[model samples]
Target: MAEPTERDPLIQKPTVFTDADSASRGEPATKQRLGPLEISASNRRGILAGIWLGTFLGVLTLVPTMMPSISSEFQKFHLASWLGTAYLLATCTFTPLYGRLSNVMGRRGANHTAIAFTAIGTVMCGLSRNMESLIAARFIAGIGGGGLFTTATIIVSDMYTLRNRGLVHGVASCFNGLGMGLGGPFGGLITDLLGWRAAFLLQIPLFVFALILIQYNIRYVTPGKSKGTMEMLKRIDYLGSLTLLVALGSPLFFLSARYNESLPWSEARVITPLILAIVFILGFLGVELFLAKEPVLAPGMLQQKVPVLVGASNFLVGACNFSVTYFYPMWFQVVMLQSASTAGMHLMPNSVSMSIGSLFAGWMMHSTGRYKRINLIFGIFPFIGTTLISRLREDSGPIHSWLSIIPLGFGNAVALHTMLIALLAHLPESHMAVGTGFAQLFRGIGQVLGVAISSAIFQSRLDAELRKRFHVPDAENLIRQIRRNSNYIRELPSEQQAYARDSYALALKTVYIFAACLTISAYLVRLPIPDQDLDKAHARQRAQAEARRNSTAEVATTNAVASTSTGSGLPTPEYPARSPTETETEPEEPAA
Candidate 1:
């Protein structure tokens, strides 16, 4: 095959490596060998990128814990549910966009854009005087947050080979877990002492630090390079982006309306958006397959079984994860009668366990270079945990509640991260950003769907139970009050409070069962994933790259010898063909 010329689209300038000239000046070699693994001198770039990404995510996780306080202060209790939903909606919508953007704009540019959005949105949230403004600000922040996560993963792919990526991913996940785990308690404590706005304000400086770290440390080849801003814009799949936005945004709107307004599924408010969402999704798919020059979601990606299966499994995992995260605190507050801060404390076990599980899985993958069995074996924990959580009652103690989540958190960490590793394994290096982004898209979808479905189930059960137990004229008012303020249960008569707690617990049980089912379903989907050796794959890739470089060098030498012989009237030396084991083998004849 002909070597790539300078103008070839596949020709990428190496950003991570130092030239021989630079190395002669005592600079470290770009690539270093350590046992079976090849480590880049600039691997610190990937580490810093992961840290920044994790810290930003940790700040974002603070919202769920602060939701109650925001509701109480704003007197817009009904809109509080939208805080997480809105952020998730924006995240899902922008995830694929950011993936494609990173491919086009380079990781540094894309990440910086995301950080800017996050910082601005965070400041907006801090200054907002009402729930509507806060929700809008969260949506804005979600766009940046989504990009931060997607780009961070893509950057890791750029820096690390598949064999080593799992450990880095796990470390990053630990940071994410730390952020998410502490978010609740920290948000609660901060809100209690300084107010909810302080939670938003505190992240601004951290985001700035992340921005600076990424700017200075992270470097990679830009997949999609352009001469100017206009050229970059021209390359974007605008129609596909619009269609995707509508496709994702519409369903979220429908679900939010359905739950917040308590509207019937058949109502025009819900049905209209639901139909529109479907239409837009179909349109987006069509654009990807047929029309766009550079489809946001590559069409070929859909044809691959591994990516499809991994994405599907990720969707289920995402749903289970968000449902548990969102509802666990609610369960503590409503059924157990804990304050927001106390409820945040109750979530410590799951977060800590999740971090531990992620680290363990990462270590296992790094050591063994295998993950299929890990995914299969650890996948059962969430199912077991959720099953037990489904049985939690008013009488369940702190230990019972806390311990139940450990397995779920542990299982989720292992399965979800493994699936990600599997996905990166399945796709070519060129498509890594898009693949990671797509996985995150599914995760965002799962979160939105999980919250919406759980809310629907909880609302229906709570309403039915309240109506059946109370025949008084003010039963509707009593139900509304209970829904508005979980704390109101403590003021009710002892028998009434018992009934309320039982009703809430029952509703939560149903949600937990649903989450459990989703977890098991994800495991089943993951069963078909082939166990491939990541180390061997990386080795093969390195060999191919080396072969290409060798071929190019040999061709240059042959051309120089021919030119010298022709000019000097000297006999050209005949070279014997090299054997397979030779470092420099004979090049193939040029194709006709």
Candidate 2:
């Protein structure tokens, strides 16, 4: 057999098999496939990661569809809003923790832990008797769901080199889009047929299946393993974690409480938490940068230009993506007078286009090994889509709404997945998990912010419109009724119904316009991203790592040889050391 070289496809790359080597050995390449699929090992891992990503996102997306059903059953419309808020809050809070934990405990252990939390939370949600209980359960599920998303991305980074990660991320994103797209329709269907509880209960088995697949097939690379439980516990940055929790939790509470309760921003419920959140954010930065030996978010990572810019862009993209995700269904339900199931079906176009966009971006990156230009080009779609969406009226046809969503969905998927690949490409392997986690954290924060801002805009506009249009003494009561139950608007007289629909349509337009501006800002920030060949970068990284290992081995071998010679009573040969000038002169003489 020939000696292996770095350029030899079969030698350096462990994730896939090359046909050239297979032909020489009279065997088939890519023989060790994933289940029944005829693909490489790396591709299989990508598929698994996608399944995990999609499942987590699917379960999270179920809450929006379930809101109406929950309100109808529990008679607490206020608490219904918390279903999504609670989940998002928990997700944002625990994402960083999961990232740090994955670094310490290994990806498999952290992943399994997340799956268990999700399953338990799902069961709790299914069995809950009240809205509060369900909210609490959703919070638990959010923790797990967030972990699944962060770790799944990290696992893809671990399994594939930079060159291949674009496609892998794209594949995973497609599943994410699929899960999100299906979640609404599926939740509504299950809710209508069996009940809303069935929606949560049905997910338990699927979680189990995902858990089993990951346990058996997914490979993990664990970093910072400790010898004992106590040591591991000691390694955790407790203060940093607490500060991060407060920093994230307080702001989320402030926004959610203000919007969900219709309180002024100056109210105690809003201002107190907002102030505390600010304080904790400062504390978090201080502890991470100056105090903690092992920071939850490393200060060094914050300093890196690429990671910082990419993370910021991730935040903006998240805001745009999730704003559309949460609001469009409401538009379909309220403005278009569609049922929850029908609204979900209307969202199918966005989901399908998003999947197509993700796959397209991935293929382009894999083939061209370029993303900056692609990102710049695709980044325009969101602005265009949102601008078009902003023009929607109450009487707009399905074709108009659906067509507008396609660009937003496609633009979001392409930008999001591609930026993730770009992020992983720029960071070192050791920091990949943390970087991915922070990206998710920012995205979650964006989702929470998007919902809060949009909700506030929608509710305030609706209230003003109702007051202006209805000059009766019971107008306030009617507005309250409509706010509490969307069905109330449908029950109103034709003129009132049109007025209410127009109000919602106008509010949505503002939200879409805001999202468009946010998307454009993301495009501007993303311009500074460094475009490098992912394959070449990974190859260099591998070479450096191998060189280090070889140097260490050589040192050990030399030391062992010296020890053996001494033990055997052999004379150690010594040579006179030459000066630097002598060495230089000798080389010059040889050349002469």
Candidate 3:
């Protein structure tokens, strides 16, 4: 046969890893060895737990604060928007694929692939020679970065029982919050001290260490028989993946072009892509529902009411969270006239609040075994915070700025932790990876939408305000220059500087109001999620485990008796059989 093409799937061979899932199902584990130390199934989870903080910190170094510096170096501040957009787009495109890919490659293989891609992309980013190359490099890194969090969540679900999963997730999210919290200041400081390229170059060592950790901890048990490469490749849903990409990318292109090109909504440049996006989305739905076998999105995954609502809520949460993250620094740096490093410092309150809120939400769920009330109570924070932030003036104080950001951070973190558990609780164990992947996909798209929408609004408002305020003979050219490079605001007369700052402050108010509306919508969607009793679910799992152990021991005793009787030429001894209450219980699927 001819060799596989580039488009052919790249799934790993069907070798069993013999993880805790199989051991729980009573399947005999295959012995594996590399050298002196033997790898055990029970200890596999320690791999990620040991390195969770470094893992997120390495990937989530948000560099929005460095945009001015990076743009200045490239001499194209107008195109700086693509820096964040490209990363979010690539992440959104590939995140769902990793979920299905993990099932075929095993988590260990999938994780290594993600890390390797990230390392390569990070180096490429550091070495980039122009704006386009940097954007391309960020896209590549995002492909890997997206999977890091998705796979970590899947592994966490596998490692813990539902009884304590909340706390475990909370701890994991706390590390994520730390990474988000620290990444800004760290990136800004690096940019200030050594330049922005060092920010990307410095992360390479952490990823290298992560790979060593995975290699030593996760051991694979070879399978008795494996399928051919072509057979496994044919099982992947290539059409669905491509169609989904188009469905998401087309609209993004429309929104981005509309702003970057300064085109009207009715212009063919914007209208054509919008129409194409709708058609492709419809095509994607049909492919998932009928054409693909073992769809990237499993059947009824979002067809159920709970999953649909959860996915929608996550989308809005993503919008609310990312909108603030991307623009909050801009508020400090442009309007308040702080240095990049100082602006990043101002982000500390938001990030710290997220860490505290995640832990609190986790503790509540672990203690009470409930999530509905927790979600409702926390969901209100984003709306309140956004509404308050909308009231900011050009002369707002540090206390006002810090106080406005805290509610957004705290509420969004709680919503993220609770929503994941809620989504998993409704899905079957087999669908956990895909379900979680879809959740990430939704949130990633929301990040892109949030930033894109906010950018468009900011640009339009800034242009209008500049025209209205400036009475110079060359006002239009001056406005364009100021819009392209925020640094130009400093070059203007002191009176013009005040006007420019006021324009930014007013435009941002509109953006915050838009985010506030999304938070309200998220709260409404969350109200109807059905509550599952986490404690009862924990009890059921324990009962089933005990049944399996008793059944295994009984079989061992019967085998010994028969062997003895045959050796002595005596009749086998009679033994009492288990009663209905003592009989083996039908095994239930593991809780997420």
Candidate 4:
């Protein structure tokens, strides 16, 4: 009988051996450095699959555990924010660490470490006794969660021809969104109905499910080489890692508490963390240039054309997204006078739109694999949408009001996912983590400012407008007071509420305008991406590297055969290759 074809799954590429070949060779899954790329087709599949799976698994694990009904019984909003932030910083922090670790342990071990992180963190979060304990537990979860988005993306480069990546990205993101939507609502309900601790328990089943899938579908990962371990270690910038941890994690930590406490903005509570971040960042940069054997998150990586320019564009997109996500609900709550539930319902359109946008990008990417142009085109849509959305007046009808946001949402989904996918296309296989990691890092940094900038725009305008319309003696004071809490707003008369809402609307308009501007800046970067069929291009590079290896081996075989197989001093074969013009480009210091 004829064998079944490889087309069983819509996105799965055809494979000749199902990585069964690795099992037969009895190759120890130990690390082997082969130029820049690692070898282990099956392991990469599991790792990649797990990364995508973990993104959903790791994130949603928080859902069923939310304690909306009993904040005292579970955790408060501040504590919950830690869960999400910890995950974000953890993912960012681990990217370089994983890249280096991939070199040391091979992809299989590095990938599995991520799973272990998720399992342990989930348990700790579920069992936490206080807010601080939960925060610590979630930080651990972040280490695992970091692997979810970063490494899965790296595997796309490691495992497939460039032609196939768009399809894979689609499948990966679709699952990610599905997990988020399901994780957020269902988890919330579980916490609301059962208990907050129940949310963390949700991950228990997901971890088991992932294990089953990992066993069934994957068995191996790309392994690094054995040479230069000591030399590489010496170059390792240990201080750089510390600096990065502080530079990023510290600032966000401060921002989380920025609004919670009253401050001079110059006090040590704020100044201390900020100072630490600056010092470390400078120290990290210095070590990267002069001291380390191998710098983590190299400056060259971020400064290059693809990584920096593209990353900057994404930062803008991130800024817009971060702003919109924070303020939209606020508009509904304060202006529309809706409860949290109703505000969420208002947000459903954009959320659902993002999900659909992700699916659409996936399908289009898979069918055509010519996604670069579409990436650019769709990016503009959100920019325009946001621009239009920002123009809505105080009296704008609901139908006309939100239509602009739909386009921006579509634009947003495509811009971020597409740009992220685009990073791998331009970068070498070696620097995939660096490329994706720093882009996301910039985005994270941008998000912090996005909120601040958007808030400042909204609140400042609101203050001026309130003063103009109502002649309030302390409009600026009112804004500062309200930001601390809403209790003060409730004291105002009905006419005051109406006037404040208009001022709030004006503030929101300016913020949305800022969002649109950020989105537009992304377009300039996309125009210069030098779109090659990256999956195919990268595959060509690897295939060429393999050919060189085989040629070297063949010469060794010929010499041995010609020498009558008697020489005790037989040497490893030299690599064979085409002439310089014909040879494939080995990625230089800066891969992008």
Candidate 5:
């Protein structure tokens, strides 16, 4: 066979071998230190393990396997969904601040803060005596959970170059997939054995381990000259952050009230929050665009084509992927009459497929330094998976149930990995933290929004179906019980049980259809993102930095020569100079 032609210059570049080749020879991943520690590449394993453990903790909370049991205990099934929503709402709201916080507090301090919050909140969740208190505790946990993953991403970026980031990010994603895949089963098993409260309590020891790992393995480095604590505090955009909370929180409140609780649209409690949400959204934009000195969400980043598209894609995919995570298991338990543990186990295939997809995308980008084709191709996976899912019936076999969700998980993982690479490729080094924050913020919003919207749709459809099927005077009370509690279906008569299962199946079908639409929209939105070569972009950044340094050095030399020759008749020594061609102005890099 003929030798394959090399179309890209990066494929032939020898320097591309630096990290991988050194690692193969058992050298440090990079000469750079992580925090104050000068650990070798082998020690990076511990850092990754710690980071993934924290991620596993965060994702473990997302599954809520004992939600049905918790709701039944509280006798407030309608409020049960809030346990998850509250966590997600807090996660999305606080996420943007972590990016900036890492700069002021240093990565170590920020990471430590996140772990502390998660630990405190998890404990409170276990101790809660009421539904309201439990939701509040979850909100606190979410505040900490949001930072763990984002800080981990920032730490990895510091360690790896753009060329190597793909592989590293991919591996990181495998941990994410591991957490996501295992979270369901783990939570289900824990719930079955010790009850839901134990699930929260059991995560505490792991959180402490993660905290110790971060302390020993990761250190915070100030970006520039050290500033006073007051000065650093000043840099945080208090106004923008607060405004963002209102902007995001209000709409979620409105959704939960209007749909989840079945409140009328014209009710003051519902309409007022919706209006406030809209108003704050506008005000938040104003603050970011013109008011804050260092805006929480930079206006300049969103002005560009790549970040905008990537953010939107993240949002859509988050909606679809998270919706599946939260609701798919309910299908097994409610419709197919499976136990919580078995339902959780059924999620394993989707999670495994997601890990495979994430690894594949990461390796591809790392080896090839290209992501455009991968981005475009993976968008279709979720759409196909969700479409198949929407058609699921109570009679659907195990093979059909297991196989249907794989594409959504696999495809969603690939799209997320590739889109992240694509966004990072176009951003300047200085903006990486905030730029990444922006993407994560959108995704967090989508996760909450997806679940909230799906919950609303599910509850509404189930209520209508039940009311239509049963005309007895007690029908209203029974429908209310069914809508609020998943476990309630099991207590009904055999005839009623069949009808309730069918109703749940139908409601889930509608929810999946909505999710399918989101996946297809995400697929279409990803089409216009420009495919920048990772190596080439890094090469340009290096070239630009070199040019600036040389220009500064030339200016210094010219000044020194003039000063030395001011009065003395001694001739000035020749200094090397660049030709006109070498001094040509380079094109400005596209803004983040």
Candidate 6:
């Protein structure tokens, strides 16, 4: 926040470059009490923001859950997941855009904007009659709900002090899990008794509650006015945002729809979108380097040692994140032979485990002020478990699958939230939002691509296997045959059923194998980050920052003395008060 003056000293401020797990750090007592806006942040509003964010996510999850219901209502089973995919894409795509917007608009304002978007979208979804109308409404809601999750992290980081950031992040994390944890039951009950449409309507009252809390309990603070719209626009890196969105969303959009379409992956429908996304990303990176003064995703942010290592690792975990979130339900439905609601019920533990992991991570970081040790131990658990799950046969029931998923869920909890703490700890303060936004965006991109790539592998392998043995052109036909006559294939079908089931099994296994590889990759990425020296550089910068602050104060004192020189005929000199950034860093022992 400080600007260098003409005679300012050359002492450098300490710039921490934590990339992933840094958000878990806790804030100090004093700083947590106030902020740049001069509003007391360690108040009820902070908790309100977390609740609103989690509720919106909960509401969004309902869209996914209700999609199948809506599909059955409209007799459009094909469009079921699109209800979710629409929101997921929007949330993942626009989070960075909201981050940049919030940087200009103020954190409190971003919260309001997110709530508005989510509320409106949820209401619209409830009212929609057709697939087209439903998808459009979900898309709008997705935009609003998308930024809520990412910005919530920023709000916690901005509002709370560094030392206490972990606690806030952990507490904040509980809300999302709570929403999902509750949503499965709540949505099911709502849909079962009231109808699927009623599930979307429930979010409206929650939004009203959140809005009332914000207007009264939350302080409304504006951003600095001096930057101006044009300067903000110049820094937005629109090309980069577009590039990132396309690169991420393209794969998802294609894969989800491709199988349903005749041409599928072979058509320009898929190929064209894929190529355009890649081209745009390459172009955006080029523009980011040469043109933008303050690019949205700065080259420095990417090239920084901590970020690069953490980011690569994040990509791996991101794959698991998508797989776990998207396919795990399907696994429960198919493997566990449970209804959709029942599958979600079974998934309750994963959400609980994630919440627990986040809290534990925050507490550990707060107490010990170190992340690598716990992170390393927990991060590997899921990788090992998920790998084991991939080896299980199709007939493997709940017990066999749980052997992998229990640890899969547990290990993921430790790895992701821990990485978040490490990241927040390492990123420079000036670029905190950008760093967080990019982390979220690329993480989303990794997820989209992971699902698409993994899905492609599954579909292709399954298609080949089915066609070779059953003489079916694709897996779809095989599934249709099974659905049409349960025992028809079983009757003639020793070889035929074996081929179809084997292909299906292979496809699922392939997905798991890819996920396991990603976990291993993430594990390796985290390993390098720990041994890599970061603390020493931060220490030097902290010392320099202190010297600069002292020097500035002394200069102001000398100016005051000069002003009192009565013999000199000159007027009293006016010295400017030092800005917050120009002032001394907080007196905390560690930078956090």
Per-residue lDDT for 1-592 in model 1, tens only? Answer: 2443445432122222122222223233355222112335655654466445644453447766787678777765556767887777777777777776664455667788888887888899999998899999988988787787787777677667788889888887877777778888888788888998998898777777777777765543321111233444576678977797788778767866786556787789889999998999999989878887767666666678888888788889888988888878878877888777778876778888888998999999999999988888888999999988888877787678779889998999999888898888776554566678778877888877777677667766776777677766788788777666566778999888988887888777788888999999998988998988998767766666467646655664565455434643443323211111111011111110
Stretches of candidate 2 off by over 4 Å are 1-60, 219-230, 264-267, 547-592
TM-score of each: 0.83, 0.83, 0.83, 0.73, 0.86, 0.76
Task: Return the TM-score for candidate 6, rounded to 2 decimals.
Answer: 0.76
lDDT by residue for model 6 over 1-592, one digit each (tens)? 2454545433322222111111112111122223333656456565556445545463434533443456666766444555666665666667666667665545555667887888898899889989889888877887777577776777666555555667667776667666655566566567767898888886677687776665554443221212333445465666766665676666665665565232456777878776776777787777667765555455776767777776677667777766655555555544434555765664566667767877887777677667788877788887777777787775767666654566666676667666776776676454567777767666665665665666556555655555566645675665544422322334444666565556556667777888888887888877866531234434543466467557655664565445444354333323222222211122111111
4 or 5: which has the higher lDDT? 5
Query: If both were scored by TM-score, which would come out higher, candidate 4 or candidate 5?
Result: 5
lDDT of each: 0.72, 0.69, 0.72, 0.59, 0.77, 0.60
Best by lDDT: 5
- Tens-digit lDDT track of model 4 for 1-592: 1332444222222111112122223222233223212445655566566567766775453321242222334425323344445555665566556555544434445566777797888899778887778768877877777565555666565566665666667677666555544554565456546666766776687777676555454433342222233443454457776777678766665554444333447777777777777887788778777776566656776566777777787778767876776566556656665443444444556656777787787667667665677877787887877877777765668886656567777777777776776676666554665566667666655654676456556555665676677656776566555443332445678887777777777777788888878888877767777666654766665675567546644664465454432344332222121111111111122322
**What number of clashing residue pairs does each candidate have, in the order they appear?**
0, 0, 0, 16, 1, 32
- Write down the RMSD of all candidates, one decimal each: 8.1, 10.7, 9.5, 9.4, 10.8, 8.5
TM-score of 5: 0.86
List model 5 lDDT by residue over 14-40, tens digit each: 111112123223232233323312346
How does residue 322 of candidate 3 score in lDDT? 73
* lDDT, model 6: 0.60
Q: Write the per-residue lDDT of candidate 2 for residues 117-156, one digit (tens) a residue.
A: 8788889999999988998998898878788877777666
- Highest-TM-score candidate: 5
Q: Which ten residues in a row have the lowest lDDT in candidate 2?
A: 583-592
lDDT score for residue 442 of model 3: 81
TM-score of 2: 0.83
- Give per-residue lDDT, candidate 3, residue 153: 76
